[model samples]
Target: MSFTNNIFLLMEKSLKKYGNNVHYSVLKEEVLNWINLKDGGIYIDCTCGPGGHSKYLLSSGKEIFIIGLDKDEKMLEIAKENLKGLKNFKLIKGGFENIKEILEKEKIDKVDGFLFDLGFSTPQIKDGQRGFSFREDGPLDMRYDITSNLTAYHILNKWSRRDLVFIFKNYGEIKNCERIVDKIIERRKKKKFETTEELANFICENFKERKKIHPATRFFLALRIATNDELNCLKKGLENSIPFLKKGGRILVISFNSLEDRIVKNFFRKTECIRILTKKPILPTKEEIEVNPLSRSAKLRVGEKNGK
Candidate 1:
């Protein structure tokens, strides 16, 4: 077997022993709801992650054509392994922003179901080395794709106070963006914002409420969203996808924050092509949150394509 296959086998063995403890996967039925769905229909999983939704949908004894989409190559590789030996499932290593183009290329005019579970996975945060979580001290690199040129390393130091303040204020919702920006600018001039620890320390020193969530939390979020163009991507993806969904087809999005949730909310509310199934998002259960603390912020909203 190839190296990718080896990784899959290793993960499978680990999962067999540990269940879903290690990965914290969302599980198939929880998100996809196979019993409520149809078979042999086309479905799209925009975030794809490790293919839990796709695997669940296919395993429900259904003959479905599924596409798993993501921007990160490493994560895509992991999805490939979990979805190995499935001929009906196709994995696309691309951003959800291009979902329309992807479908058009496949010669598919429309699909029955679409899913987008936004943000990073557990393997991404818990690994601590990826630098996505402020709790974990690693390099300041938060780029979703390591192959990408821009990173938190560059943004914290290079961006002007104006840009820094704007992102912190808008994205992080950091009430004290000015203070945070000032600190970042002052510190970076003497040394550099190359590591996560340096940035975290700067925030702690400058902000009074840093202890609540590590002052770097929102700043880092702003940087990550700006670097990846996440909101813009979601907008583009939703714009492109509306036309490609089959009549009565479903669009399910799991957003991690208010910004992303708002995007999905507005798009579904305004668009003629989609009818909102969830006027309000479905949040994770208290039990789920208790079991997996990472699930606290998760919100799920669903939409259905109108007019066949």
Candidate 2:
């Protein structure tokens, strides 16, 4: 076997041992039901992290073809391994925002369905080096694509107090954002924030509040969103995809955050060529949450293109 194959083998072993920590596809039944594929058709897994959904769709007995896209190359590699022996699919290194360009490059004019699961994979959170979680101590780098210039470290250390405050309030929706920003500014004056633990500790120590969630949760979320520019990407991706969907084709989005859900909701509502399929977003079942705790916050919304 080649070195790359060896690496994939190791990844496969690790997943079997540790239980695919990348992500658990939430609302699998609902997604499959809502998508309602019949016969052979081209489907796109826009955020095909580790190929969980793609695998599910491929095994559904339909002669379907999938085009999987993701910004993270490492995740894409794992997805390739996870989806090995699947002959009817193509994996590409790109974000969903480039859907139009990707379709053009593939020489595909239209698709049957699109799925966007907008959540960080469990592996991403568990990998301390990625710095997505405060529970683990690691560098403050939270870019999904490491090649991206902006990172959690840059936002925490370099951004101005005003900008930090804006990020906390707008992106994180934290109530006491001003106080958190003040504390961050005070600490950075002495020594620049470097690690995830450093910033998380600062927030928890200074912000003495009794809450259901961690004090650093909102801060971390804000930094991640800003680092990735996720909202704008989602907006552009959704808008660009409408033109590519075949008549009666569906677009399903599983969003973990309310902000992202709202974006999907509003886009579907306003788009003339598309009709909203789900009046209220679908939530994961109690049983699914029991099996995959990370899936508890997931909300799925769907839309279908109208024949014109």
Candidate 3:
């Protein structure tokens, strides 16, 4: 076997050994039921992290095909391994923002459904080397596409104080972050913020909170959003995807943050071509939250393309 095959074999073996602990997709039943996959239908998994949602769709016994897109190469590699031998599915390393170009390139005129699960996978947060976890100390890099030039490090050390304040206030919703910004400004002058821990600790030291979540949580979130241009990307993905969805096809978005949820909600409402299926967003059941607390924040909104 080749080196690549050997690596995939090792990963497969490891997954089999620890299959019980794997992080599955959120709201599997709800998503599958709402999308209502048709026989021989084609679907696009906009954020097919580790192939969980794609696997679920492929297993629906509808003889459906899937096109999975993700910006993270590591996630795509794992997705390829997890989906090994699955027929009629293709995994591409690209952001959902480029869905139009991707579909055009694939010559897939229209698809039955589009799924956007906007949450970081467990592997992403657990792997500190990727710099997503505030709990684990590592480099400040937080690009979903590693080849991307921007990183959390660049934002923290190089961005102007005004830009930092804007992100924290708007993206993070942390209204009173002047002290924190002032401290980051002061600290970066002497020694640039180079690691997740350094930035997390600095935020915590400057900003105190009595909430269940860490003080650095929103700060880190804002940094990740700014670094990845996540909000803008979501808008582009949603806007670009509608034209390619077959009439009567549906779009399901699982957003983990209020901002993303709001965007999906408003998009579903204002788009004359899409009929909002759920007037209110669906939340994870208590059982799901009990099983995986990380799922508590997830909100699923679905819309069907109208024939208009």
Candidate 4:
């Protein structure tokens, strides 16, 4: 067998070892259709995750080259192993916000599209060890980039009441957080918050569960966002990619929460160098939500680079 085919066979064998669990790319069809990918076009999967979108993009055309990036090495490993057989793709370990530096290093001047899927992959959330979810008990390390110094444990245990209140209020949008923050501070004084279950239980004890979400949902989300500085990174990522996009090239973002959606909406509105393609954000279909309930809140926004 040829070298490429042998690689493909090896990849298939490795995939069997990882099992069938895979991250499903939200709004896959809509994103592909709107990006308007061309033959031999170059694209960037800013948050490649487990390479769901990147794999599809690669399969779309033989000459469609993809530069897949993710801060999480574990996720990148999955992406790499999944696409090992694929040609015309490069996987990089870095923040999506560093796309300018990445492209510069790669000696590429511009790309046809940039795609950001701002949601946790199935592996990240399901793996209790990584601590992205409250469903399973694990450490409070919520850093997407594990090398980062900050973690959910540090914020909950070491941060002051004032800082705790700030994140709960601002990032989690938890109103009337004085009582919750007070409780957190008091508990941490007795014992350091170390595990996801500990925090989840603490938050649950303080606040009743919301309609469909857990009481700890917003708190965990806030901690993850804070630990990773996700909002800031997202803003920078969008800004950094714009200048590198070919004219008429698109930037697509699939954000899962209101905070991320708001940032994307505002960025698309105020940016002068891009035209908003989706006046209203495209939402997941009822069928998609039924299949993957996690996608219910996904909002996809598109912007095309305009000649200034």
Candidate 5:
């Protein structure tokens, strides 16, 4: 086998040995049900993290060709492994914001459906090295594509207090954002923020709160989203995808937080070319949440392209 294939084999082996615990595709039935794919043509998975949704779609025996795109090469490799032996699929290393360019390059005029599952993947959060989670200590790097220059470290240590306050308030939606900014500025002046645990600990120590969730959860989320430029990318991706959808073509978006869901909801509401399919976002079944706790916050919304 080639080196890439060998790597995939090892990843597959590791997943199997560990009982494949890290990944779960949420609201599979709801997504499939909402998207009418009776005569499947071309479907695009915008995020395509580890091929969870794509794998599920392919296994449904639908005669569809899938184009999977992701910014992270590591996730793409894992997706390749997850989708091994699937002939009618192509994987590309790129962000969904460049969907128009990618489709043009591939000579695809339009697509029958699109799937966007927004947020960090399970492996990313669990790995710790990617610095997406506070549960484990790792470098303060939160870029979806590691090749990207900006990192959580830069934001924490180098950004001005004004900029930090903006990020905390707008991105994090923290009520007392200025206080958090003051604390970050104070802490960073003494020593540069280095690791995920260090920053998370600092936030926890400075901002004491009684809540069901961790005090640093929103703070970390804001940093990750800003570091990756995720909101703007989501907006561009949604706008660029509209013109390329075939009449009656479906679009399904699974958002993990209110920020992402609002984007999808507003896009569907304002775009005349598409009609919202679900009146309200669909939530995962209690059973699915029990099996995959990470899926508890997921909300799925769908739309169908207006007929020409």
Candidate 6:
């Protein structure tokens, strides 16, 4: 097996041994009470990361069957293990963008509630080979689905400086995109950047300085987003999912960044079929933040299909 495959194996073994941490889903958001799921109705976990939400409500949702969809098959395999010892649960290796097809395959008419936890699962970030974190020594690849050939490596090495600037400015929210672009191009000309550490070091040494955050944060974010086509995937998923939901079905999404949250909020408000459950997004409390450091950046929003 290749080094990448080895990394995946090590990550799985560690997470399984440690029994991977549990995470909260949108159902726990304070603004979430507005959208209530019926006990006997079906629920969909569109992005079932680590299966914490399902574990919490499984007994309560005993009457409900859950169908979890994800683009990453490795993660889906882990999800199957996490959801083991439970009936009325199914896992599919596919993108949420194919929600209608998944529903069709299940032969289910309409789901009562659909759940989306948009955060990258912890294991993905923790794995050294995935190269999501600056701490890890790994390839620049950041696609959640390794099977999807395109990756951060391709973009950094091949994209025009104009595209780099565009991604940094629009996706990374980083200022001085032009300078960043110039630096990336010049550095790549000397040598093709392959590893996360190599690119991160070049940005640190040659790029403009930032006291608030790492200089490469935005560029990395942009590369990952571009490689995964995340925004479009989310939009497609939502558009396809709502149609398969029962009239009164609910859609709950938890997003980590402003861009993602804004998309979810605006889509819910503008959607004709959805009654916005959270006119404003719900945020984690100070207490919640203290417990889970990642919760600090989280924002939860929900909407219900407008019928009974």
Error of 3 at 220 (Å): 0.6
| Tens digit per residue, CA lDDT, model 2, 95-166 | 898899999999999899999999688678768899998876999999899888998988888899889888
lDDT of 5 by residue, 1-308 (tens): 44333434554565566644346788888877877765568999999888888888887888888899999998999999999988789999999999999999999988999999998887887677999988768999998898999999999899998888888888888878788788778878889999999988888788864445677888898999999999999999999998899998999999998889999999999999888989999999988865655677899999999976
lDDT of each: 0.76, 0.85, 0.87, 0.86, 0.85, 0.75
Worst 10 residues of 5 by lDDT: 1-10
Candidate 3 C-alpha error for residue 148, in Å: 0.4
Displacement of residue 219 (Cα, Å) in model 6 is 1.9
Instruction: Give the runs in model 5 whose Cα sits over 4 Å from its true position.
Output: 1-21
Worst 10 residues of 3 by lDDT: 2-11
Query: Which of 1 and 2 is the better model by lDDT?
Result: 2
Maximum-lDDT candidate: 3
Q: Extract clashing residue pairs from model 4.
A: none
* Error in Å for residue 304 of model 4: 0.5
Candidate 3 lDDT tens digits, 136-216: 689998888999999999999999999999999999999988778998899999999988888888877789865556778
**lDDT by residue (tens digit), candidate 4, 1-308:** 44333433443454356653576689998988999998878999999889999988787764788989999999989998888788898889999888889999999998999999996787887788888878768999988898989988888889888898888888988888889888887878889988999888888788875445667888888898899999999999999999899998999999988999999999999999989999999999988865555677799999999993
- Candidate 1 stretches with Cα past 4 Å from truth are 1-22, 27-30, 34-36, 85-87
Cand. 2 TM to true fold: 0.92
Please give the RMSD of candidate 2 to the true structure. 6.7
Q: Which parts of model 6 are misplaced by more than 4 Å?
A: 1-35, 209-211
TM-score of each: 0.88, 0.92, 0.92, 0.92, 0.92, 0.88
